[model samples]
Target: MKNNSAMTKIPKGYTTITPWIISRNTARLIDFMKKTFDGEEIARLYNEDGSVGHAEIRIGDAVVMMFDAKKEWPDTPAFLRLYVEDGDAAFRRALQEGATTMTEMTDMFFG
Candidate 1:
């Protein structure tokens, strides 16, 4: 029986689950995302040192948050699965944006 309606507002175009990336250079990472996935910057919160404390970007319908790595919270790599309209085109765009190819684009059966 606790009433807690006064909370931070979640931005538009975001779901309950969001992926956050902790990068050494948040601006560089944002730029990469823009070039690679056609991501658009939705919101950003900057730190005193001019580094990004928190930032959000939208790629297609997926919105992801990112921030600079801090001593208290270290970097942690994560795996992201994006379902794009054209897998081959998206893969090519990623390569063009300096992503190393782990595997070639291929179709797989889930059923």
Candidate 2:
């Protein structure tokens, strides 16, 4: 008998994107993603008061994890590492659209 299975095609490197939530505006972040990156919400967990406890979004072929800040994790800032065709252009657009700059776009030895 011949084994015939549909092989799954995968990207060269696939990774999940997780962003920390510190601002009081998790929902606004969701909206920003949709507007900025055309992200679609996949799953969302919310508090009783409608605050987002967690959320998953799919932007293009990548998945992004997001969540609201909890009292327990008071100091963790949202961190995201995204790979795009043009990092400089993306960085500029993000800045033009009001994203708070933690670091300016620079080519590093690691990147």
In terms of lDDT, the poorest run of 10 residues in model 1 is 3-12
Clashing pairs in 1: none
Q: Please list the C-alpha lDDT of all candidates, in the order they appear.
A: 0.82, 0.69
lDDT of model 2, residue 59: 71
Candidate 1 lDDT by residue in tens digits, 36-107: 778899888999989899999998888989999886776688678887777788788788877888877777
What's model 2's TM-score? 0.63
Deviation (Å) of 60 in candidate 2: 3.5
TM-score of each: 0.78, 0.63
Q: Write the per-residue lDDT of candidate 2 for residues 1-111, one digit (tens) a residue.
A: 764342334333335323445655677777777766767888788889777878877777777767777666666665667676777777776766678887667888988
User: Where does the lowest 10-residue lDDT sum fall in candidate 2?
Assistant: 5-14
